[model samples]
Target: MTLKFLVLSSLALLTNAHMAAFHKAMYCFNGTASGQVNYNNDDPVSPLWMLKKSDYWFHHVNQCDDFPPAPGDFLELPAGSSFTVEVAANRGVTSLSFNGQFATDWGDGGNHPNDYSVANLAGAPLSSSGCIGNPNMHTQNQSMAAGTAFAISYQSDISQVTMDNLAVFTVRYNTPWKRVTSYDVPKDMPACPADGCTCAWVWIPNGCGEPNIYMQGFKCMVTGATSTTPIATPKPPVWCEEDQSTCTQGAKQILIWNQAEGNNIAVSGFDLSGNPKSPAYNSKCGFQDGEGFHALVAIGNVVSDTSPQEHRMTSLVHRPLPPQRLQQLLHHPHLLPPRPHQLLDRLHQLWRHRLLHHPHHLLHHLLHHLLHHT
Candidate 1:
């Protein structure tokens, strides 16, 4: 039993050691130049390793060279993921052309950098020479060596990658100065999100034609898998033609109204034809849910119907009628035919007053006045 236990323990140790060696941890560039050119650090250097990168830059110049983990270093990229790298350091005006090195050597190679895609590495591990042959890799020439920022980017035709793997890259200043960053790119793409998660047509408040209102960078690029869900644009309220047939003599006012699909719709009325036959009355009003909407429009004092057969009467309904106008209306009642309901209501109101208390006397006087005039 002891012999069996020893054999199992040996197998387990061998397996762990083999797995550790399987990654074959890669090395960063060691600056060996004399007098302030060398960076002293052990393998897998601190703070500056790349894990997952959506977009990244290494700002070594301008005192931005502090060691910090790369932002977005841990990423679960969908298929067809891509990235760009930028260098802002001055490497001098020499015309020598050199490619930024990105390497596939997890740990096996010297200070050489790797530019190969994680997909390619998963398919077949890249040699140092293979890393150099990448088509989308960036090359630095004398023109770009003057400390101006320059960038290079690459995309992989290969769709997928295996997880738990490392991608390493480095840029050289003088003497192949290597402070490289490494990333752990993800294998599987994230699941597509639930629907209705995005704004289909973002309602820009009054954003129709004004150039001042515009979409932010994030909103502009968004597109749904299906055509963007269409939003029901709020419709403007509309005014319908008012009924003119109901206009009659002695009617003090009429109501004007409009219909709208939206809650905020407002309504107004205008006198399009100023002709006396049609007359003019303007109105303004708003709407609410249960209370209903209406606008009061004062009837015109003077009425001239388009047809000659209709009786013509003028009303002074906008304000209190002048004494002279009232006298004229009272003496010539034929001009303003009294509506039965309005006249009866007026009589009832007058009966309540002390001045014309007796309905019998009022009726007798009105009859004599009408008959004598006729």
Candidate 2:
């Protein structure tokens, strides 16, 4: 038995382990707002041609050299998964580039007091050539612990009029990113969920327009994989020992009223009042149950259509014995064994649900006022 457990544990670990990943879409020339680039090539129509990317500079000459910069200016990607970033090749995109060095201010050309590696030249653009032959300038590792940060300089080479075929994909991990553990987010794809788990449709275009251009660097990736939190149906507050403390004893009672005519599902309504009455039943009103000179409120508690059959009989025709401020309890957790109350609870539950969820019900105000006055 121990051996079996060990094997299963190993398998689970193997399945959970994952690599770094990114989602890539068409690289528009120039930033979208600046009109520096456009999407060309794929069905949505992303196109690529002989246009080598300019030097890696944003805003000012030495602007992006600073640390803790904005997202569009730089990136710090993990290497757990095999990341193969290729730039659209019109002519000069040769390889990925980058280094760990960064600057917060674009010092003018030649202004370093230390003068360690230079005499002058402050705003000189850094290159991602830590190694060479790559333009996205990158680092490779298995994990990216929290708080780890890196800086890299990169650019796309527009040296030649290369083909326009869209980039390709290769798996780097053993388990699937979306299905196995985390949810997969595609760069060029948008997904719409519907009908509470009944069904989902994925919009995927099998092809891109420019079959030759390659995209550079990290893609706007999806963060977490938690889809939706499951909610279990709440059970009715039964007449259990735990609830005895909350209920009033001896001739005191709570009145729950059911209004839904059928099992049919509709919208919702507003009815916070269930039992409204004497001060004893409601401490705020100076009412005490069974002991003091307290009276019960007129409760409008919603009972469902599928209430337990045993409770229905008591609910429809419950008669209490007269007590001298002593022991005639009305609404107790202990359900009457012989009452026919099935279909009552579910009906009430549905009505309340509709009232809250579909609050724009045309007859909400009308129905609420009518029921309240009655």
- Indicate which candidate wins on lDDT: 1
Report the lDDT tens digits of candidate 1 across residue range 1-374.
67445433432322101000001111111211222321211211111112122111121221121232223221222222222221111111011101222222222122233432423333333323232111111112112111111011111111121111101111112111122222111121122232101100001111011111000000001112222211111122222225433322221111111111112233333423331111111111111111100111113322222233322322322234455554554455454334333334333433444335466756854665456545
**Structural similarity to truth (TM-score) of each candidate:** 0.15, 0.14
Q: Note the Cα lDDT for every prediction shown.
A: 0.21, 0.21
Candidate 2 global CA lDDT score:
0.21
Residue-level lDDT for 144 in candidate 1: 15
Clashes within 3 Å, all models in order: 17, 110
* lDDT per residue (tens digit) for residues 10-31 in model 2: 3233211211111232122222
